[model samples]
Target: MSSAEAAVPQAQWWHSFYGGLQKMGRSLQLPVAVLPAAGILNRLGQPDVFGKDGLGWNNVAKVFAAAGGALLDSSLGLPMLFCIGVAIGMAKKADGSTALAAVVGFLVYYNVLRAFPEACKAPTVLVGNQCIDYASLKAAAATYQNPGVLGGILIGLMSAWLWVRFHRTKLVDWLGFFNGRRLVPMITALVGMLFACLSVWVWPPIGDGMTSFGQWLSDLGSWGSGIFGVANRALLLVGMHQLLNTFLWFQFGEFTKADGSIVHGDIPRFLAGDPTAGQFTSGFFPIMMFALPAAALAIAHSAKPHRRKEIYGLMTSVALTSFVTGVTEPIEYSFAYVVPALFAVHAVLTGVSMAVTWALGVHAGFTFSAGLIDYVINWGLATKPWLIMPIGLCFAVVYYAMFRFIIIKFNLKTPGREDEDEVEDVTKA
Candidate 1:
């Protein structure tokens, strides 16, 4: 077996780190998995189902849209998903009790954090160097109470570790009530409160940072979107690209409806029938639906003559996955570490795609990843959905040529073209 296949030794630092990241990734599955359904429902709710303008709203669509509201909101669906997913993913025995503790923990964490700025009389920071009055700000901030996905992930990790550590601990006979699963909730609550209190000092700086960066991106305009796109692609290596989206897609600024209703986030605004959604997300469509798939084909074509069959099957499957499902990790990971330079170029091209999408005023947000499925349903709402296809075709050609040229010129070890002695037998697709 290859050294990469060897099991990481127990109780080591790297093992612990790896295990933690794996847990975070696993906890994301339930929440992430549900988004496609939310996207479908939201799209079904939109008036223009067949990609044409002037269709009146459908009753069934409105019902689906209303029902889907529960799932699409970050504070509502995502937190609960984090609670259940983390508890289940992290439990040694997958006990219902662990999940129960997680629920308690999740509620307490956000409640405490939200109450902090209020209890301390911290003024609500607003757009353009203005702050709302502290008394009124308390009510508005309390109403929002969003911690983003990172908070949920952290709470999950903490609660999971606490569950594993103390779930089996024995207490003195007189205090046995606090020893088992029952005790987990109380302890988790206290920990939640502690973090909530800590967040007063911690959360605001982050908000400020996001505001500053958001302003910078806004100032840069189309190029800023492009830069964000590239950064999003590059951050996949560290598995934290969603951090950037939290600001732009969520609450960097407010969106006022034509009827004077207010909303937050790209997806929320889009679902609320806004024409301009998907500022940060739309660019990903061209890259995922066309460019990367073409890159996959190029990888297949460039493989050694003897390995073409295996390469063909693997790349084709991953290409389809990227185009249809909006999941590009399989194709990306195939060459991520092996050909870092090519990945950098991919990031640049992603930036360019985002710039082009924004420049053309084409907008369509997704509840999940950007792909053909979302692009189709959201087409009518988009400014120029037709433009995406032609742009994507162009990007596909660029990616294909780029991949072929770079791989051949540098003798990069991409999948089937890897050195004979270093073949990776496991095919992810």
Candidate 2:
């Protein structure tokens, strides 16, 4: 067999493994993401959105809420979760070393950034007034209570990559223990600290910029949601969606808390399933869970007679995944690389989904994307959980029918609709 053919099985195996890991990560994110939000909301005096109230109605009845608050205060909530999530998601082997490196990197970054002002401290009498209080210093530097889980994830991924790339190289015999996987965490911590130092000293204003940008997006209202939805998908093509999400979801300047505090970090976390917390994510459910799959169905139904069965099987899987998990890359990449026009249509539909959700004021949040899992968590924890199911089903039917009709009418070259020669060559070769 040719190298390409031989490699296909390996690729498939990797894909399966990665897909499973992604699902696991998504599952973990649901609870971890909610905890911080729940805690914050509890502190702010909001009852459980899930309707857990009773006659007693004591503040301490909020078990999740109390746990969430402790997690946030300890700084072990989102940061630690992000480190583990990113490490496992990106690592080639799912090794413990990768996770260790991620954790170390996050700690390093946190300590470095957290300590810069203290490091710069001179005697208070000489400088005027007492040495800056740590909190005041952090606030002045634009570093809030949370630096953001997204930032932690990025650092974790970077650390894991570094470990993978250089684990085998030997530099010193005396420091053998620090080589390979063992050294990943140390390196991560060092690197993070360095970055933190640089952030506080040379580039403090960057935080302000992030905050301003988030605030600007927030101010745009429904139009902002539509723009975010379109831009998010567009950026995904170039691998910049994470950066955008960080700016919007994290950063104190971007969002104000119910208590009027300038809160840093995710809007969803701040609101904890408030239904109004995840304005950006709310719009996505209709599109990913509904519209994309419908498009896929359209393409599948339009396929040539001989290829119809094969195409249906493929599209069926894609549709289910999109509906349940909100991971559209599998379905999208199938057509996007081959049929640019169809992909464009998909993007337009995404924008429409955002606009529709915004118009209806259906707000919900997720750590990952707008999949069924997130829909359930946000909805269940939200004040109005019942609304999601009915709304979601409606979108699903619309998406499937619309997609099917479009594919048949336009003769789009979706998977099953490939030319006869293409199929023959694929099968024969």
Candidate 3:
């Protein structure tokens, strides 16, 4: 192929990768939406909350706990949800068959992993009266190592792709019953089995590498957190933060609970009550809950006086969204391209927030975004939760002062400062 042609495919590959990640993020919302409710219920059901001995509604609290706990239950919880959601969301069209295929594929895939040692004839160890495949047992015991959420995602993606590719395939006259969508599950089962067999040999080393990488990151401490915060804000410009989240939120870090069950990723570990769980997440509280909103206020104030009224509503809405829901895109995108330097500064400020929070030993986590709702809902689960407030207030002042200075000094076009005609057009629109 010519050089241009080669470049075309390379560019296409990146586009596909980015597009796929976006789809995966959207698809995951199906399952992720349940997390806030689950987290709240789980917390409220704890002995310290509604379940306290002095509380008359201990039984009700237990019920609430069980209800939420069932959804969060590691075994058949998020993994299965991801499978069904991805199968439905990633398909060319949402189809029940695709979901069914994902579930079937996931089951076969998980069992194959679970049975790998015996299937491969790996040596077993005598454990009391039973001969246990200790290696396999060990892998099984570590919940993170088990083909958990990642495996579900893999199977779901494969099943969805297969359904899209073969769901309409025609069969021989006698085999008409297996034609069309019915063929998807059959193919997925075979493919899932092969995938599982391969993963037995392949995934262990990959898992080890990931584990090693997590350890390296952990060793970096606040520096690592600072780097993550910078990268996260930078990646937001491209809407590719989901790729980082797939690893950091779902697969990074390992924590063992008092019951000896292992949980991986910041969100899971934090919900499971791991003391060290929030290093990856706590910093965003200041950035999302306080800093960005303050920055929004600065942008509003910096607008031309004549246009201030027109832009105030927009700014107020986005600022409230950031503070309450931790969605900062509206505010960030307002000036991200208009004044790239300001965005860069914002990214650095985010990194500083992350580093400071980590260094202070402040542990807080969220089911959704780092917003007021999450901060309050997860307060009981956080270590030194009160500290986040003062930290956020400080960040608010810094963000307001810095953003106001930058916008005015550069005459930046942030929201209300648009050209006269453009502002008129926006108003008309």
Candidate with top lDDT is: 3
Clashing pairs in 3: none
Model 3 alpha-carbon miss at residue 109, Å = 1.1
Estimated TM-score per prediction? 0.80, 0.69, 0.88
lDDT of 1 by residue, 27-123 (tens): 5665667767877776676556622333554666567766666666555565566556767776677688788777788788877665544332355
Best by TM-score: 3
lDDT of 2 by residue, 1-429 (tens): 999999999999998876644443443343344443544344433353422343345555455455644444323455566667766666666677777777777877776655433333432211221244554453222232345654566676677577778666665999887777776666777788776666556454665676677667767777777888888777655444555665566433334434333334555453533334565666777777777787777777778888889889998998899888788888878877677766676676677676767667666665456777666655544534455566666766776776677677777777777777666565454
Summarize candidate 3's per-residue lDDT along 155-266 as a digit string, tens digits: 8889889999999999999999999889888999999899988887778888778768766877899998898899888988876665566567766776776656556678
Pairs clashing within candidate 2: 37-269, 275-363, 294-399, 294-400, 298-403, 298-404
Model 2 TM-score on a 0 to 1 scale:
0.69
Candidate 1 regions off by >4 Å? 1-26, 48-59, 83-95, 111-150, 197-205, 256-263, 421-429
Off by over 4 Å in 3: 1-14, 53-59, 117-145, 258-260, 424-429
Q: How accurate locally, in lDDT, is each candidate?
A: 0.75, 0.62, 0.81
Between 1 and 2, whose lDDT is larger? 1
**Top-down lDDT ranking:** 3, 1, 2
Number of the candidate with higher TM-score, 2 or 3 = 3
